[model samples]
Target chain A: MPYKYIGRTHSFKGKTLWEIVGNLKNFGVGRLVVRNTVVERYPEPSYYRILKVETLPQPKEESLDNLRKVKVLLEKTFRGVTNPKPVCIESASYKTDYRLIPKDEEQRYCQYKAPVTNEKIFPSTMELPPLMKEVLIREMKIKGEPVVEPVMDIVYNDKKRRIAKEGEKPTIEIKIGLGKPAALSLYKGIKLE
Target chain B: MFALNVISKTLNLPATKSAVNFQILRWRRKPRWVPIAKSKQFRIPQRPVIIEDEQIELKRLFNNYRTQMKSIKRYIVERFVAARAITTDPKDIQRIFDEDFARCNKINDEWNSDIQSKRIEYFENTLEENINLAKESLQKRLELEQFKLEEAEKIVTEQKELSKTFITADNIDEAIERSLANPVDYNFAVDLDGNKFYNKKTL
Candidate 1:
């Protein structure tokens, strides 16, 4: 496989790869090499792709030896390249990319019918049911909008209160249980980011 | 424009380097005065400046689309004429419009598909290239690691052999430390850059 840039963005600084290109409009570089990151992993040394850029520096040699010199050097360098590749002379650029997410799998669900629902069942006399909410940040975001990483917290609790009768001037009594609300928070990240 | 230098059947191109754009830090002042020790500069009228590549690309894209729209007007007028020239047969004109719209949609679909195919091909090539490079590098690393492991294995074997040859100073620790100080080719050392040692003679 050939090297390909995943994205043009360098989300991480200084770790980006660059391909050396010739400035054809002015000085024509004889050969170009891409600057690659070094791979230190082994059985062999991990290699960041390195593009070599070499050009003849001269008061303009009158012969065709300019290309020959580069050719010779390249020929000497890549002696074992069985499938010698040609370089893209016009434009030489590599993409330095940020991390990417993996693709999602296809939707697959197994249909199963459990027993019928029990209408009358309670874990305890003082247990509160769970409540879930779907929240959305319905707003148009600009480029420099502050990024807020949402935090989620879950809690559970039970409420205990006595019944009240207004006719006898009775008052309502309430007690806080040790258990908190069993909740899960879903934060909406900034969109149009 | 540059001078072309030909050498050994190849032309040498002048490589132009990127020049640093001078940055003049500016701020507002209340007409302050400074002596020889200080250098105060005056501010000019404020104007917009191009600071990023995105702006340049946006401008180019806008101009391109504008030019394309200008060129596409003839087709729009033709369609309008065809639509207006109908009086007796309304269905025919509607059919004409429908046909025209369908044709347009088909044309668009075709064009898009064509461009998308090319883009996909480009991406595929790019992906392949990168994958290959990565694979190559990974394979090389694996080999190097294996080589290192083999070297380590050799060190162990060498110690075993030396144990038979003669009991060294303090088991293998002293021997290994001495070896490390001298630094024999353990085969763990690797330079991926493949940079040849610079030679003045070669230059």
Candidate 2:
């Protein structure tokens, strides 16, 4: 009799990291592995280069299909940018979502350039609120000082990966009013009054 | 009771229902220890289908939204860091502290002066009120003393007038001789017309 499949189907497409590394010589070191879920989300090439792999002792009672953690050192390159640091893949090693890239395709994957776009410029300063501006102007007049239009300086915090870029000519202006809506259909049949 | 029962039957009145005690079980997955049901062992769940165009559009919208959100988050973080950033220079910190202290001191001085003026006014008003109260109390005491002196003088004058009738040692013989010559009688009878009749004994 033919065997019947049980339960809801999983979305995982590729074998687990151990399934491929355990069979290969030298634990599949110096090999490229890609996650299908990451590829589905990003159009850019994203893969992990296995540097080292270590198999953990399996429990006597538990089956091989049960979750087992394996330590693996990986050099990850996501969205065409290679990370400078080596990352350890342990908990996710049990997930059956990693696929080893073929030797022939590795050269083609390495040939693609990192996508570059024009740097985005943000406003260096923002205008003060209307009431605040009025109050500042009145105070300046009372002090007999030259009245200048009060504006607040825009400051950016440093981050590991910053989306905002520094460049001449600001493309984006930070303002203190209702901005133009992105979708017109969402605002249909609505009146401002 | 029989008539009531007949009326209830005619009206088709419904019986009162009692509250039910029950436990509401929530929908959840079976525990890991529980084996799969025999009938559902071979059952497979259907995958959701999505249109290619709609998927592409959603992806693009999500990408744009993520980029915008990242930029906004970075901007907000940068603004917060800038606002909270402290000068490393001790001189700058000291200068700032001094300026703040001076401003606070000036405000404090202004408040103190305002309160001082009010306190002075309050003290002057209270002092005048206390003096007026003392004066009124002293006047009342003086009037009371004068009234007591007059009452004492009236009592003394009445006592001096009554002292002349008092029998002294020097007037004893004359008082006895006058008493002998008068032979006073104390027993008397009065009629309804208030006429008194004295009964005298023959000596």
Candidate 3:
């Protein structure tokens, strides 16, 4: 961690989230916080909850894979939790935000091995590219704008059912349990078109 | 995508077959670590110490906490719903929900710092031992993955005579074997995964 004049920011999807989640899979990340702005008014996510997986530095037994395992466990186990009303999830694990992700420091992620030479003499020169770096720093400026539209929408409706007999419409209160009671109740209340 | 495949191969596990990757998220900063001295007066109220985020292990523990809440809530809701089924009073439902929340929080309490510090110490010690062993084990296995274009290169180099009898789907051994050889009846054949294309076995 270095102290500099500014921070930079950038947006990534698909492989980006995968990389972050992958890094977390083996190692652990700190508690992620989001802007209240991002949490509310994001029409998609009805409930919001952030996840933390255990990671230890010692005997080095804890693997990022443990985080991955846990991610799977949560999603699989909670699949039914947020079904009818999806909870829009926006996740970030930052050394700093993309907007603060300065330009020059973008490409410096950890390198595993040197790019391999193809002469075949011993291809021993081959190497795995180091982990990715925060690259928005070099090519572009980190501009601020309205937060991007929400990206993740997880549903928490595992136990929804109609109590009304075929024709006799029923008024029911179903608690799917994504963990935000207020949001869950409000979402279930808005008239469905 | 490229990296995913690399990891899958490195782990020697089937790619995304049954695995689910989870992410750990921590507060932008260190969580206020409760002081070592257990408070007695509701314990003396004190401000959270905002130290520079240290302890990578502590952060990992938090990520699991973030993700598991959904499941814990579900378990609570299950009991909530089941309890409600027994009676429809609003207060009853509220009581059940409270009970559920309390239980979930209680389970979370088990992973508190008091217990985790030790787990971290043990986990880290074991990790170093494993990494060295892993490096040695993986050294012998060639980790080369031919980029897609390399596939064509391999075909040309391995088989100068590209025209083939076995390569074409029309000439596949399975299809050929299934052709009827008997006068009025035919024997049905299935492939290794035990899936039948067209059952030739007569009822």
For candidate 3, lDDT tens digit of each residue in A121-157?
A: 1111111112211232221235553433211112233
* DockQ for each model: 0.00, 0.13, 0.01
Better of 1 and 3 by TM-score: 1
Best by DockQ: 2
For model 3 chain B, give the 10-residue run with minimal summed lDDT: B49-58
- After TM-score superposition, the amount by which residue A105's alpha carbon in candidate 1 deviates from its true location, in angstroms, is 99
Evaluate chain B of model 3: give its TM-score: 0.19
Flag regions of model 3 displaced more than 4 Å: A1-12, A16-18, A22-42, A46-159, A165-193, B1-203
Give the C-alpha miss distance for residue B70 in model 2, angstroms: 13
Q: Can you write out model 2's per-residue Cα lDDT over A26-130, one digit (the tens) per residue?
A: 998998999889978788889999998889876566654685568899999998889999999988888889998999999897677756786566666666657
For TM-score, the strongest prediction is: 2
Which candidate, 2 or 3, would have the higher DockQ against the true structure?
Answer: 2
Q: Which CAPRI tier for candidate 2?
A: incorrect
User: Taking the tens digit of each residue's C-alpha lDDT, what string does model 3 give over B1-203?
Assistant: 55556566777886546224623355586457855443452443454553333333345445434434444455446657886675579898899889999999998887686688898999999999999889976764434344555787888877876565345676676555655553433455679999755545544
| Per-model fnat list | 0.00, 0.19, 0.00
Residue pairs with backbone atoms closer than 3 Å in model 2 (clashes): A156-B78, A157-B78
- Please give the distance, in angstroms, between residue B142's alpha carbon in candidate 1 and its true position after superposition: 3.8
Q: After superposition, how far is residue B14 of candidate 1 from its true place, in Å?
A: 54
Measured by lDDT, the strongest candidate is: 2
